[model samples]
Target chain A: MIVEVRGLKKVYGSKTGVTAVDGIDLNVADGAIYGLLGPNGAGKTTTISICTTRVLPTAGQVRIAGVDVVAEAPHARQYIGVVPQYNTLDRACTISENIFFHCLFFGFSRPAAKARTAELLEQFHLTERAEAYPAQLSGGLAQRVQIARAISHRPRVLFLDEPSAGLDPQSRIAMWDAVKGLRHQGITVVMTTHYMEEADELCDRVAIIDHGKILVEDTPAALKQSVGAQKVYELHLRDQPGRPELCARLSRIEGVSKAEQTGDGVRVLAHGADGLLSDVVSAASPFGLKDMTITEASLETVFIQLTGRDLRE
Target chain B: MYARAFAGLFLRDLYVLRRELFPFAIRVCMNPLLFLFVFTYVLPHMSGGAAMNPTAKMAGSGGGFGTVLLPGLMAVAIMFSGIAAVALPLAQEFGITREIDDRVMCPLPVWAVAAEKIVFSAMQSVIAACIVFPLAYYIPSVPVQAHVNSWPFLIVVLLLASLVAGALGLTIGTAVKPQQIGLIFGVVVVPITFLGCVYYPWAALKPIPWLQFGVLVNPIVYMSEGLRAGLTPSAHMPDWLILAMLCFFLVFLGWRGIKGFYRRVLG
Candidate 1:
């Protein structure tokens, strides 16, 4: 593992303080893309902050490439690349200079800094914007510049926090492509985001976090499989009938794995049996079934299954 | 390796300041230039200007008003330059722009990052003092009587004064909020300059009794008085006291500022 987090914890105050991270442990393999999938305020950002040494851990330790981040942050920084939620590109310098100065900060000679900056500009397709100031760039373009600059030193681990937040569809796709390219360069990536599709699409492994605790950690496929269904069918019915007995009946159906009553409906988790939909409709219609919505079992279903709450909510 | 990383930070500051050279020069030169032109040249050259110039009369005999102002104005330049170089940029960095992360994330210890700001600002303070010197020397119609008895004392005072000014800037930058920066000029900067003995000799303020005793708390008073003793040899404070106070202020302010910076950056 390139990144090892052992019993990591952070608290904002003493005793009665808000615990930002609560005894989290993670081991990310070298050259793999990992995701901490959670909603806002799930301690994902706090975990990343401690790993990058921006925030001190109240307990435990994080070691990146064998160097402890808390004990030798400056030494650890050489192997760490971070793209924070906010754009931290130096506004005083042009795009090229931003990368160039970053290289210098890591002790690259002037010639090496310039050459590496030029290479990164071309690699990130930012050559045309080399002379453009950060303020002159659009939000998406500035984000690209920040990512390019963060990797200027070729760090072993790259951390991205909410990489696609506030981006348009096109820019989000572009950002994803750029991140996928980093994997080919042999950099381990650990990203934090609430977007389930992003974790399903990009991460080899995903950890679902809520209220400063890791609810589960596994491959997205395994996590979805662990939910024990291929589809989730939500049936909104009009009458308030014997909800528990009705759910019991639904759960006993051949393809249905679980059934529960939600705020406005009955939720059924079922496999894609040939006649499951009609069977569900027949069972639910007596209560004046008003509407039905079907969604494939996804990382979101995995989250809702574990936490009993929607990721977005 | 630490030295190399430290140099990289210094080079970055140098590069940015070089690009801003024109504005930096204007900020450093304008105050002393205008002050010398009006007080030393324009007013002294005016008919009956001598009668109107109370500071010149106080300098007595052949000593022009420029003699007292020489050290005092240089102190002002050094202080302002320090503030401009560190505090102003810090306010913006800690505020909306928030681009300080990359700088702080450099492969140096956190205190080293804050130390770099002080060192860079101190260099600018020295440059500002140097710029202010010629303006004070050549502006007045009458010859400014600057008699330096000890070059070592003069050099030591200039170096100490520059570091002290930079430390003061760091303290202000870390203490003041970005929104409250404009107000600091009014509440802190201007008031200090006025009471700092910048326009007159400290000894001359002795007649004012309470005001003289009150201004003793101002660090700028020591700066102006130190320069006066070193460069002009007028009625200034003792050298040992000036050195001790400058060191005291430097340590106190640097400690506070670096602590604040760590809190701001490290969370």
Candidate 2:
């Protein structure tokens, strides 16, 4: 394994403490793109922080490329690079200087640092903005600079924390391409994200975590299969929800695995609703709703089923 | 391996400062210039000839008390600029943005990160001190005579003082959080500025025993006295002991700073 985390535990305080990560075991193969999919505040950041030597773990050991993280953090850090959830670039420095700083930190000479910075900037399509400060760049450009900085050191393992959190569609796609290129170069990658499409498109395997525990871990295809990739019905209601008790009653009806009230309507995940459309309407008749539409199963449903709640919640 | 890593980080910081030299020079020199205007020119006219009474023995030509105080004030300015230039930025990088994370990943040990910061800050201190030399010559009223004999002592003391000030900065930077950085200036910097003998000598504070005792513990007191001893012939403190004490404080504070920095960054 390129990365191994066994019995990892981190408790915040002695009294009234909370376990950010509860004895979780994780493995990432060499050159694999592994996704740590979780909702907000689900211990994903804590896990990445420990792996990257940013935060200490209360218990457990992390080995990167066979080097112990706690025992030899600097040496282990040599084999790994991390992109934090927040952009940590020096906004006062230009784009090229930002990347060069990372290279220099890894003990690269000036000439070597310059060459490596140029290569990464070109790859990230940020060559033109080399002279611009981070504050002068767009949100997408700043994210790319962060990515470029992380890879400038050319570590064997890369950890990305929500690399596409606030990006638009075009920028998100561009980021995906850059990450895929890393895997092609035989670099092992570990990332955490809530974008289901992002995880589905990029990751070879994913582990879903909730409330400091892993709910399930599997390949994206297997996870979709486990959740019974069936059609989902989304109802657009006429008025706001009046009763939760009535909604729960409708959810328990035949052919429906779950029913929950959304902002303006109810979402029903049906198991066998090929011709059961009218039945769903009759079930929801008491709620005085209308404008229903059906769609295919997605990773959103898979996430909801594994955790027994929506990813956003 | 450690030497190469340290050099790399050192050069990188220096390079960034070089590119922004114009604005950096203006910002650093501005503080000392304002002090010169208020103390050398405005305060003398405000106090009229009251300043002449205190320094009548050394009052020669137009220069009097203002001339005597110029070198001491320049030394204090050097110390302040050193801490402000590197320490504030270092603290911010470590706390908020975590830009230090990249540097910590170097093959060198974690303590080298703090050492590299001190080295750069000391260099900046040297530049700040040199700039003060020319300005002190121009500030009339305090017409400081350029005794060529004081060059060696001035250079050595300035280097040691920068080390002490930069190390003190590192400790303060690591001890506080990002939000409380402003509080550091208000609580620590302000007190050091007033009690450090910047405006007067330790001998002048002899009249107030309680204030004298309090100022005795301030490192800036030693720094200011040492600078005055080098620049001014009739300075109050024993020059040799002042130099030795400044060296001791630099080594002690630097050792403590490196220990604390590693514990915080690597732990």
Candidate 3:
């Protein structure tokens, strides 16, 4: 494993009594893009903070590249790069200076630091902005510079906390590509994000956490399957008297797992094959259903099923 | 191990400081210029017939008063530089921006990190003193006669004073948060400047017995006292006493400041 966290426990205060992360176990293999998917306040930041040695863990063992973090945190940090959710670069310095400082912190000599900074800036497409201070950069540009700084030293593992949280669609895609490129260099990437699609598209394995506990952990495909084979179908039709009762009755029929009227439409939750399509079509024939569409079991659905709350909330 | 960490921190701070070098120089120049004009020229010319004592008058008369103010002004300059270069920036770095996270992550023990900050800040303090030195030579009645008698003493005193300020800056930097830093200036720094013997000798504050006792706690007073003793032959304080007090304050503040720094950074 490139990273290992076992029985990590962090309790805020005795009287207050909040366990941010309670006995959590994690194992991430090398070169894997592992996502710790969760909503806000799900201990994602705390977990990453502990791994980065930003906050001392109340109790646990964390190892990066087989080196004990607690025993030798500074050396352990050499193998791990952390891209915090917040911008931690010096706002007073230029983009190139920021990268240069980061390299110096890791013991790089001046010329070597300058050379490597140039390479990373070019790679991140931030070479033109080398002389610009962080305050002069756009949100997406600042985040890219942050990534370039984090990776300038070329650590073995990277911890990114909501790396693209507030980014626009195009910037988010660019961030994802940058992350994917890290994997090609055999760098293990661990990230936390609320964007379900981001987790679905990038993560090889995701650990879904809620209320400081891992609700589920598996590949995105396995997680959706574990939730159920049932794909939800929604039928937008004119509301009629006794519509909910009729939908409930239809749900009790063979081939349909559950059905309920939500808003002006009847939503049918079904399993098995598309053969059930005929049964649903016949069942809704009398209701004059229109604009029918099928939706798969999204990570959001699995999260809601497991935790009973929207990821945003 | 410490050497490696020290070099890294020194070089890193130096590199960033170069970008702000112009502003930093301007800031260092501005404060001392204000003090020099107000005290040596404005205050003296405004007040009749030497409310300033003869030692001060003579020191002020032959274009030598500026020399007397030089060391004290340099002390103040060094103090401000320590606070500006290390304490204020460190408060911010540890606070919202939290860029110190990167330094704390360096492959060294936490104490070494804190030491690097003090060492780097001390280096800046020395640079500030050097810049202020030439400006101080222009102030009237600084006892140019004393300069040759005391150049070596002056150099040593300035170095010791800078170290004391650097250590104290570490304490302040770790003790306060970024938002409260302005309050530190209002409450802590203002008193240190006025009572810190920047304008008068420690013995001069003695006649107002209560005031002297009150200002005794200000470490800047000892630094200025040491500088005055070194730069002025007829300075009120004894040379040995000034040296002794400087030694004491350097050790006392250094021990406490370094301890707090380690705990804050390490924890």
Return the top candidate by TM-score. 1
Label model 3 with its docking quality class: acceptable
Candidate 1, residue A12: the lDDT equals 90
Best prediction by DockQ: 1
lDDT for each residue of candidate 3 in A1-313, tens digit (9 for 90 to 100): 9999998877777799788888789999999999999999899888888888766778988999999887888788788888888788777778998888778778888899989998998899998989998888877888898888888888999899998888998999999999999888888999999889999999999999987778899999999887664687778775466578668867776767667666667767678665787777777777767668888878887897777577999
Model 2 chain B: weakest 10-residue lDDT segment is B52-61
Q: After superposition, how far is residue B87 of candidate 2 from its true place, in Å?
A: 3.5
Q: How much RMSD separates candidate 2 from the native structure?
A: 4.0
Kindly provide the TM-score obtained by chain B of candidate 3 when compared with the true chain B: 0.87
In terms of lDDT, the poorest run of 10 residues in model 2 chain A is A237-246
Instruction: Give the Cα-based TM-score of candidate 3 against the true structure.
Output: 0.88
Clashing pairs in 1: none
- Candidate 2 residue-wise lDDT, B63-138, digit = tens: 4565556666666766776568656887788777777776776766677778888888888877877787677668
lDDT of 1 by residue, B109-227 (tens): 99999989999998999889988888899988777878888999888888888888888888899889999989999999999999998998888887899998999889999999999
Off by over 4 Å in 1: A240-242, B45-47, B51-61
- Assess chain B of each prediction and give its TM-score: 0.95, 0.90, 0.87
TM-scores vs. true structure, each candidate: 0.96, 0.87, 0.88
